[model samples]
Target: MLTKELIANIYKKVPKQNVLSKIEERYVYAFDASDLHEKVQIPDAVVFVESVEQVQEIVKLANKFKTPIICRGAGTNTVGACVSVHGGIVLNFSKMNKILEINPVNMTARVQPGVVVGDLQKQVEKIGLYYPPDPSNLKVSTIGGSVAQNSAGARGFKYGTTRDYVIDMLVVMADGSVIRTGANTIKNAAGYNLGSLFIGSEGTLGIVVEVTVKLITKPEASEVLLAYFDSVEEAVNSVNQIIKHQICPTTIDLMDNNAIKTIEEYKNCGLLCDKQAALIIEVDGFKTVIEAQMKLICDILNKNNAQNIKYAKQKEEADEIWDARHSSMAACAQLRPNVTTDDVIVPRENLSILIKGIQKICSKYDLIMCMVGHVGDGSVHPQIPIDMNDKDEYTRYKLAKSEIYDLTARLGGIISGEHGIGLVKKPFLPKVIDNGAIDYMRQIKKIFDPNNILNPYKIF
Candidate 1:
């Protein structure tokens, strides 16, 4: 769909070293965090865009040539959002990485797209402020990718997801016009909350160039607890019981025995954990406040007949305790070279049932499936490990995926949480979204980018 002459022409309109060809340079743009997508083919060209104006020129030229254009950040999306399926131009935003401004007094920071989430956290904490959205891939994921997908994290159980922290953003539209969606102020009765709307649009609406996010005062004290259970039901119910007690922990995460065994086998880290289910819980506040909550947590776990409840006192101990939970993606990756991870959000009370349903499906398929979740908010990722070389593997994989989504919807759950409806979930979207809403969303996409040039074939 593209040729060297057309790419050369586009590069001629920008700075030197901005354009790439199909042979070797274009190979990097072929894939993303998604381990199983149909396939990835190298794009005809790749462009390293550094500025909003440059993006504008590239988009205009892409529009002129009627070629597909993909906007990519750290390429961390668990879907094919950045894949150049039609072989057009791939635009990488790494060069535009810049921390523009930080306002500690107001607890807000303005940053360009390519800032790493962990780097942003480090920068804010140094100034006595905190950016609390810490995704599992924070060290490698970029803010642009996080905001684009409305990324959530372990902190989401307390601080809420990235959407809650984002105040405003600078987005570049299809025709290269730059528009600001939100304000830095605390509250506004503005026109539709466009900023919130675009937060999880998954690059289908526009490309986020700059972001303004709110920060919070870091908690002075924290406590980590690990509660083990012989049954998933008990472990999941414990989370609800803890919530009913009105003790909101900063994070309450779950790891089934399969997940633990997989991680322990992969790292030989001596988890010393063999229970059927475990909850790695964290509560943060002032020293006295968190201490009281910690006691209440212990009581609840004991009441649930938890097999074991372990506590970590020091900061280092807490870090070590949570390391296994944090390395879930890596642990699962070691299980198979290819993995298809799905996110489903159910009511907090139904977490156990949802997990049970997933286990049933995994067993029925005779698959070696592992599970882990953000138990606080009821977001679980059941990774479907695959050997992509085998064609029949995906056929069963698709069936399992179909049953999972349908079952999640039947249980009053959502198809996706934290992750957006990128290409991977496009087909299932119709199953979850109301027809009226889907039609309106399609209309909105048409209104914004009539030519479907912003990011074609993403959410839809």
Candidate 2:
């Protein structure tokens, strides 16, 4: 819907180097990390926004033309949150990446939406602070994408997700008006908490231009423990036992046999491919108490018939252990031409049943699924590798995906935990959410963007 006149208007709002309208350049913004071939669409124009004013101008222009304005950050989100499914305008935030303020005294950092998550962590950690919302690929993922998806990583069990850290945000509504969701301070007992409405809205509600994130003091000591189990039940039982002991580790992540094998073959991280499941547990606290915690955790694992357990002795060793888990998606990509990852979560008590159900469903469809998850929070990500070029395989993959969501709903779990319901999961969202709730969501979208110009048709 972006006409030549409207494209010229957008170029007038930014520098000459900021706007991209060439066919080749627009093609690059068509897709994201999501492998859903059916949902991909190239935008008519890709505009690189350098400031809040430019974003507002673009939004106003979009509203005027009734064109969709899809905001894009690093575009690393696995749920196609940044894809332009409709022919409109794509707002690239790469030029707006800047850490505006780091208030050490207040323990909050005000940053542009385009700032890299890992880079922000490094900068904050330099001042003896921590921002714990990690989305696996934080090295390249941007703060805007994480905020939009409400992303959490392995550490989510202890530290919570991006929604917990984001105290305030500068959002641009569809009408080109600006609004601050909350104040810069941490504990706001203020009215409504309007920020929550847009945090995980997946760019469907408004465009996030700036965010103020709360930070915590860095822990004195932390270590990762890799434990192997002969059966998935054993690994799950170990998790329950550890929780029963009242020990709160930073993470309780699990990987199934297929995930282990893929990582071993791709990265050769010395992972035991023969193990049915593996748990990566991390404990952090005072240096003196870490040893006691590790000792107790070891006892629990051993009691639950853990085949073998290894703790990282050095920082490099800890990185090596985490590398295996972080490399899961990349490793699965090596199995076939295209790989799709899903997020499903249930209550902790049903974690084992969920895993087994997913395995059975994938096997029934003859799909290769590498499963990994943050078991502490009962979330699972099953990465399935398939050749999209093969029509038969693609059909089977679609069927398997639907069945997996059905199993998740049966186990009292939603289709997504960390990954928001972008285009990939929109079709199945109604299965979990009630019709009344969906109606309210639709009403909210109408109230926010009456013209349906801001990332239109997402999350429904």
Candidate 3:
């Protein structure tokens, strides 16, 4: 039970309307985007914070009461990163969304934690600037959540992930004290790269209040092409061949036969469902070089046994191709009652084996899976649609999940590529990370959050 004094103290720190203490209001904050069916503990209170001072005040109150302070954005993370497992105070950043500054000369943007990723992209693109960490759900995902999970998408093959752009951050430490992670300027040769520690920390060490991200000039021209292959090997080999020819496309995303058919059925996007796999390749650069890049990429695709290659002739067609690729999860969800997605990455050489292994495992377990990935970077996202209410199916899904991680380990790859190790992946962290490294991580966690009040029992 929440004490009257604690409740009163919270109300004093924030506006009365911002404090949510009713059971109905608190219940909604218990779950995130993770598809886990396990019962979750509802938070005792949910507060919509508007300023850094309000966040610090809440952190101080959390320290006094020793309650877990879970920082939340849109709660779109698929790994249960923002779920209130311990039922403490959930600090919602929705009201704090703001883009404070956009410096064209410095090529940087300072933003509040609640700023939506796609919204920022549009605002920056109004100028000639580009912020390139494009998560699949960028339309709804928040920058703070992307920072916590180090989220990446198809563009990651060329632009890198969220960590590459974040230059500085204003973090409220566990003790309600605020600290700047890096300098405002781009180059910071300061003591330690403290920002790196918190970039993928999943809000365990501190609460990110403000962020400064570096930006690059927008590409002058871009084009998208869909290439179908007779077999998975042909698709994988085509990716390698493209790289061997010294051609670097912005994204080389792969979608298996299941994904192609599923998305076609889900949206009738004109995808070739008869092929075993498809590669969605995009190239961007100076307008003068686009035709040359497309010609080279097309020649390589035809040489590698690409059955049918289709290049988007217009911007509408390009958007349709990308929309189909990005809708893999949504398409898969239509096949079953629940859908779960996993991120596993291996070396480019082992890409074919990883894809085949996952397909075989899913087939053996009689589970329906739609596989899509950023093959340019050797990261695959296997989205499985299942009926979670079926006990036998859930059991089989668990077994297949463990075996998939084992296969990933044998292939010399970690379990996660961009998604952080939240509650769903915590049990399997040992499969990829060494004990010594995890021990050090725990020690560091203790040093920063001594009370264990910041997103406790996560990412271990």
TM-score of each: 0.96, 0.98, 0.99
For candidate 1, the per-residue lDDT at 361 reads: 91
Q: On a 0 to 100 scale, what is the lDDT of residue 333 in model 3?
A: 83
Off by over 4 Å in 3: none
Q: Give the C-alpha lDDT of model 3.
A: 0.93
In the range 177-292, model 3's lDDT, one tens digit per residue, is: 99999977889887989999999999999999999999999999899999998899999999999988888889999999999999999999788899999999999999779899
Candidate 1: tens digits of C-alpha lDDT, residues 1-460: 6766677778777776777774777787888887545766677877888888888788887777777788788898887878866678888888988899999888999998889999999999888788998888888888998988889888898899899889989988887788999898867788899888788887878888899999998888788988789899888888989999999998998888788888788777666556898889999889999888999989989999886577987788788778877666677778677866778999887788899999999878767677888989999989767777766776777888889998888888888888777778888988788889999999999888888877688888
Give the distance in Å from residue 238's predicted Cα in candidate 2 to where it truly belongs: 0.8
lDDT of 2: 0.91
lDDT of 1 at 162: 92
Q: Least accurate stretch of 10 residues (summed lDDT) in model 2? A: 77-86
* TM-score, cand. 3 vs. native: 0.99
lDDT of 2 at 331: 96
